[model samples]
Target chain A: MRVSLFALILVSGITFTTAQEKDELPALDNPHNYIKLLAQDAALPALQGEEKFILRESWWSGRMEPGKAKLIQVQLFRRNAYQFWLAVPNRNGEPIINVYDSEGNLIPSESLNFEGTNIVSTMIQPEITGVYYIRVSLKTTIESPQDWAVIYAYR
Target chain B: MTRFFLFLAVSVLSSQWGLAQEAPVKIDLEDPNLVFVSDSVIPIPLEIFASLDKMGAQDWGRQIESRDIRLDANRSRTAMLFGLVVSEGFIGVQAQDKESVRRLGRDVLALARSLGVSAEVEEHANAIVNGAGRGEWEMVRQELDKTRQTVINKMKELRDDELVALVSLGGWLGGTEALASVLRDNYSAEGSDLLNQPELIKQLKLDFNGLPKRARRGDLFTQVSQTLEHLESLMRSDDTGAISEGKVIEISLATRNLVEAIYES
Candidate 1:
């Protein structure tokens, strides 16, 4: 009986450690995944028939509090049509995305509103190559942090 | 066999228990964004090359004198050379130069061996050479991208952050040199826009400052910083990040001179 108990304890310890390691992995089902989905959705209706060269890295995600602004700086290349997607699962937090050039002047861009959807996307064609800062903000007054993600692809 | 069965059972039960504990985290089932998809962000070198390629830049490999870059004991210099070689691989694909691609592949392997990362790089370089032989441009590009990422990830794994920064700086310079060379010969409005990268300059400034004092004091780093400052002024000249043709020439010359300096020193 003692030998059996010892085996059981060892098995449990090993299994627990294995499970703990899996749980400690970077959260896969977060806002970043959502941004990727939105990017796929944008590919269909928006970039239809265009050969899409999807950039599958550099997706940035963070928690944004209501009534606060978060600025993410990204370098964009010239002469490529880039589509940027911003989305969150929460409906109470209305998120707006905008792009600005290096001098902080707003660049003209077309944005798709999320009236009944959980995703917002924008497409910009920078005539010149340079760094552009994207400002994402929540318009609501919720105290809880809303997880958000921004992703872009150029073709 | 009995012990194996018991272990499997325990693992399965433990996983189920973990799911049970994680179930109460309140994930919204109705959210359409919950549908998972596979994609990743674009790296800066790839972005720059894509833009340059779109603007009808051709035979960029002729502009890259990667042969001049030498291997060194300093991991930082080695890392930088690796970046230039990978960028050269991209131009080889653009130029469809099989011999150059194969040579750069072997060179990348040599550099990786010096940095203690030959294991991860050997396969990618082999695939790159093999792909180039078949004129599989897309496959070669993918392998090159993987090679760059693998090297950077290995550097990070070894806790060599300084090398990581230097590798990127090297790749950036290589890409810039290629682009600037094309622009120098064929000055188009669209081609000039690709150099409007003030944000990258700012980030590089921060990266340069973050380097260890030993690396920061290095002559290469100091000279690169001076060039970055010059590029920054050019990028910020207009709100739209546009630069004059003359400014483009200046940057192109500065970048080419810097690349030469890298090879000489």
Candidate 2:
């Protein structure tokens, strides 16, 4: 599953490692080929040690009215150059991703827009080294009396 | 004995609502359980508040307000403040811990007046910046209510984002009664009449089109969404036929995700 595009280039020094297991995998042009999140799993194997959170996956909900705005909280741990992807299965075709500096300011709001899915992804840099939050809720004007959002994050 | 039982019942219901808020460190002014936690903010530079005031754009060298300079330099420990700012704009706030995040949220709420959407926002800004005391919570609630009323009142001031309410209500069935009540009270009959008239729904479609092309997409369930919302609102109008709290909870969950994602966020 660790078929890193960059790693393949860096390890080019080795003459033949037999193309690695990921060779059997197609290039990630399709959502079907992309890695699927099946559980509340650790991101990147905890290289910086254990970081804790309350609700990390699609595990939370908020009460909002058609006229009131609500913010959903997803907390991230540690500050590093890491990517954050957001998806709403019921929303627009692509995910809107925003990259931020360590200070939580936007670097850019990017989109991965994986086909067949409505997910947004971005790279984030935390201003500090603790839990960072992402708001996954509705704007008052866009709010349906029945509308809310679902979000999950990986470090 | 009945009084004792009633007391226990009230306490139990309130406690459960606290559990439902889902925040690891939620401080609800409305919740009785939260009274145990002290309401104090970790003070920072008044310059921080000043900087936020000037944040309309990403100007590299925008001048700061002179009042902020005096407040920043005042450094009076005798005066403490209730915070009314949301933690979003502050640098690195998105990265803070739960306690820290809640503190920022609480402070922001306390400083709500300082958030100054108007020139009068400047007058109360320092009072809010200094923080709201127990005497101020009622005013805060009142202020929030007035803001809600003002928005509903100025429906012609409605923009594309304002369309959120129309769609969420889903053809006036979900909570049209509740919305109607709000609208009639805030907006004139001339203004609010369209809220119920089918012609307004048609006008809404036209208005929605005038928005930015890529601003947002109609929901996946857009096909039957309007019908469903109208049905829900109609059902809601009659309190007797309403669904149980559990199913209503499920619908509430769906609405929050959809409405927030499609319109709000």
Candidate 3:
């Protein structure tokens, strides 16, 4: 049997299938089965199941010394898919955190507030199975003024 | 063993892919009068001084023409304190060297003029510093008594009793020097006369005219301006505090001292 999976937008503003829908869908009924299909939407490479494997960490003790950025990278993948997310915590004042992608591409960084700290999390949705990488650094301010965030990801 | 490697490979591959990876999302966080929205989804208090006003709609028409040069009271206070410290700490002359003392005296006069202190004190302070550096000790000693009374009169408009105590202590601490080397160059007669004179403590009470501390907190543009204007004329003060600077340092000093002493003791 074939059924059309309509996009019933969730109220949480995140446009991905929730747990309930994932359970009911026969396409994913077998946990042992992996998906291989045509390009449903080529532009939508993110197939709407990320943030699940996001690493979880409890503490960032703020031992960040001068001239440093707390770098964080979260990578997710399946057999034929690769996904990546990278972000640096905003440390306000004169310093800031810089973010870089797997290909060593530079992205803009941000500043933290007066308390002089910030945290960011990465959630990547995989479309094709491939390996991914992330690089993070400080774009502005003194170096190493922050501590590394606890990496929280699903085992 | 193959299956275990497969499982490990799959798990490693999964970890590397970030399976749930999605494009970054950002909410249009609007702050009407936000000061430093430096972090988080949380809202912080507004610094409400510049182009942003909480009450009115953001007039984009005027915004293009407008500048954020509304001179935040915070910036003014910070800048003023910096200026005050520079003036007091770095600009004054000691009896270290003849040429150096003359240079410092010149610099102090320039700073006083630029900072807009009254001309009388400026000139008197200049003459004394210069004369003492020149070994014209009598002229230096006379100006000391004059500056003492001048600064004392300047403090009278203060409503802050605590601040008055601070200024009093500062005056007394500054007193020993003012009579010795400082006054010796300006006023030798009153130099020894008021060295540790208990009567000189009366200058602490000179600050009775400024409004109560609480009244000084709000819309200083309205309150501080009007009150300072009235008090300036009453005290015969210069137009230094005429601008609605929320921080009147001289006024704050009297209150700051007493509060510090209280807190410390």
Candidate 4:
């Protein structure tokens, strides 16, 4: 399965490289745009309450190959609840989200589990005030490199 | 099948929640089980203290109140100064200090000039000044945020990512100083809790460590890095949710001294 996925990525890269040679814009421009918008849209309702959580304005965006992950470093304050919203381009790949503590131990939060969805959210009550890493990964192979966006809020 | 899986996941999650409610999660700072890969920061230092108002902490803006800042003609210093001034602008808005905001607007322009990027930021700085004069606090805040973003984007375009790190560090330090000052006077479990940001200090360390040796070798950067390391150590020692008052005082003094060193020198 891994070999097949690697082969698929090579084919996708070649196809896109060819498209670039022909002067046609790649299918995903500013690849992280759609996922960013998804995070923002999901966060709108989260912001409606009287208790406000500051949304970090600069949304995190990146492209990931299948079975690869990007780590977003975040400081989750103690005594507050945090929600991480992730979105990816449609059919690009499955989204996987996990949170790890400073020592790299996976903090067992329900939000870490992926149920085969493109849009996923993780909510964690940080047991301590410290740095936590949010790992966003593409769980499957797609024809092209997938772009992903993640936005988080705390209250 | 997807629906069935979703239902099962939700049930499992619900049970986890129930167990969590029965026994609070205990985090051990010294636990050797901590593990993770390398990371990138989200950079939200300014907003970390939004709960201060609810906690009824005293407002402290004195560190920025009077200072003759001597800035060398260095791009990195100027960039970090730009972030410090912008963060002060935020504090001015919080305190409703129109004069400080206006002064900070001018300071922003001066730093931009020192960095040789004044043209890109002059308009926003001027708007911030005008907004402060007219008591448009919210508008001033918006312009301050815009000004920082503009400067950072321009710095990136110029390939001065070292400047970006300084900007983030300066801003975080400035914001942290303000919080520590407030918490110093009004020490409470909740108020002191705001000072418990080990992760942010860790991220700042990473930012400095990520810098090229040339950018990281200066005296000012060295001092700032040392201060951050101290704070990180202090934060790691306290695992309980309630931070001790003595530690709060220690952190407040350390942060104030570091802020003065970085912002004034």
Per-prediction DockQ, in order? Answer: 0.13, 0.01, 0.01, 0.21
Better of 1 and 4 by TM-score: 4
Per-residue lDDT of candidate 4, residues B182-246 (tens digit): 77777776657667677677777878888888776678778877888889866543545667888
Best-matching candidate per TM-score? 4
Per-candidate TM equals 0.70, 0.23, 0.21, 0.73
Q: Name the lDDT value of residue B122 in candidate 1.
A: 92
Which rank order by DockQ, best down to worst? Answer: 4, 1, 3, 2
A91-122, model 1: which lDDT tens digit per residue? 66666776766666666776765443445666
CA error at residue B88 for candidate 2, angstroms: 15
The digit string of per-residue lDDT tens for model 3 on B104-210 reads 34543443343234464576667766775676643443344344334333433333233323333333322222212322233222112222222222222233224
How high is the DockQ of candidate 3? 0.01
Every candidate's lDDT: 0.68, 0.29, 0.29, 0.68
- lDDT at A84, model 2: 42
Every candidate's fraction of true contacts kept comes to 0.28, 0.00, 0.00, 0.20
Model 2: CA > 4 A from native: A1-155, B1-135, B150-242, B259-265
| Per-residue lDDT of model 2, residues B1-265, tens digit only | 9999999998865543222111223223233422111111111111122222222222211211111101221111001111112212121122212333334333333333332223323333333222333224323322322332232223324342433333223212222222232233333322222122232233334433444444323443352245344434422212332233433334434433433332222
Error of 2 at A143 (Å): 45
Where in model 3 is the C-alpha error above 4 Å?
A1-155, B1-104, B107-111, B151-169, B176-211, B214-265
- What are the candidates' C-alpha RMSDs? 14.1, 27.4, 29.0, 8.4
Could you give me the TM-score of model 4 versus the true structure?
Answer: 0.73
